[model samples]
Target: MTEKQPQARVMIVDDQPMVLEKLRLVLGAHSDIVLHVASRAEEAVEAARSFRPTVILQDLIMPGIDGYELLARYREAEELAHVPVVILSAHDDAVAKERCFLLGANDYLVKLPETIELVARIRYHSGACISRTERDQAFHLLMVSQRELAAANVLLAKLNGIDELTGVGNRRSFDAAMAAEWSRAQRQSKPLSLVMCDIDLFKRYNDAFGHVAGDFCIKRIAAALTEQLRRPSDKLSRYGGEEFAIILPDTDQAGALLVAEGCRMRVEGLAQGESSSGLRSPVTMSFGVASLSPTRDSDMTAMVEAADAALFEAKRSGRNAVRHAMEMRAGQRLNA
Candidate 1:
């Protein structure tokens, strides 16, 4: 099926009333063209900007601004640049034609050409202008779509990294962060610390209270653990159910121990009230602190293992205590 095209807009600019009337009469015969007339150059510029004509018919000699200056103005304007301007002049001088071309006129014609020739030129230039406008609109829409897609991708990445229930970094995010921090510490020869924290008797707590209350308890403990670290480089993640991990970038054993102890004290301070199920007490968490001057040869999993082993010791030594990986190792060596 053939699609119907919209009528092309034609603007005639001339100071002479007779010339304007003639052009208007010629264009009025065609139903596919809309005619707009301006008797002054300033009025022409204003009309072109507002009307957004597909083609412009401009007179070379006019009051206030001549054809050459008006043509220059159209060429300079971003919105008017795509519309073709055909100059109408009484004198068909070679120098005038060359000057008009240099000023960006699309075509130069003596006063008025034959009706058929004028219509053909107007149709050709108007069609070209329409094609250019369509292409520009399509390109702009594509750019907007690309920007929206990029924003959606960023939001997806954030949602993937976050734990939905606790609003903390999930296990996948923790692994990525740990690998990156490990490489950074190795490159700078700085100490990096990791703390594995578990709620003491969390299974018992969950068994005594409902899972709903257990969930609330974990969220509160996570917030308390997050509050212990002061450095922007430090990160905390929900390692698994009832267990959390802290990344202490550039922090040594002493600093890590201080942060771990702070988290322990904070969790112990959380208010507890008696429930209908059973008698409730304040929640306490155990911490396992491990710091290492990371080297390129060291395995990342070994650090996690050390932290986990320290955590086991903390649990063994009558729960709710903080244990250092190095201290555990030293004690083990002495016993051996």
Candidate 2:
């Protein structure tokens, strides 16, 4: 079955009572038209704002605000600007027709138009107005959708750089942070320190408990390491399996080592707590601290290599200790 179309709204503005009555009689026969009448042009403007007519029929001659001036006003108003306006006049003069067209009238008609012609004009203009309104609403919705999509992209970018398991910065975030901090330190001639942390005998712990327990252990250790660093410039990230990294901006070897020692102690204390699985082997961590006064020519990779070397020495010297990069290098030369 075909659907019935909605009723078209029509507004009439005329100072003469006879003209308004004629328009009502002509429009009353059409069941698809809804008519609104206003005796004054001022009332027409207010009615247009509230009633939102699809088409308007206005008499050319009216006292205190003629139809020509009212047509210009309607064209200026944002609400009624798009509604098709038809000018109605008793005299069919060329000058009056030309003047009405210049003032933005959509159509011209006699004082008492034929019923069929009036109904046809109203239907065509009202259909055109409805199409324009639909297009405007669709464009607005498209713009809103684009804005929401852009916001979602930004949120996805942030989540992409985060570690899902540890709830900390991942390796990607770490690399980005390192590059920015290294550049800042080089420019300001400031010291930058790195700490490499590894869980002591993590494989053994996983073998004793399950992988689920191992995950819990890692998360707890990550939290403890985070709590040990107080400054905003200190950043921690999960480097790899059972390993974490800390970046300390504007920090020397002494300061970095102190922070690393506190982190080691915090993890050790957590390990001493009773476990549900009765696997209460003291979980300890070893830390390697390296500090460098960055220069323009220095590479950030060299600092990471030095920290890795210190981590090797810490593991070799039994677990649960902090090793400095300079001390590790000196001992390595002596051994060599």
Worst 10 residues of 2 by lDDT: 327-336
- In order, the Cα lDDT scores of the candidates are 0.86, 0.85
Candidate achieving the largest TM-score: 1
Taking the tens digit of each residue's C-alpha lDDT, what string does model 2 give over 1-336?
876666789999988887788888889878889999888887889889988999998899989988888999999999888899988889888899999889888999886777888888889888899888898999989999999999999878778777888988899989999999989988998989999989999999988988988988888788888889899879999999899999999998899988999998888887465464233467899998888877765767877877888898899999889998763232131121
The C-alpha TM-scores of every prediction are 0.75, 0.65
lDDT of 1 at 221: 80
Clashing pairs in 2: none
Candidate 2: regions farther than 4 A off: 1-132, 273-281, 327-336
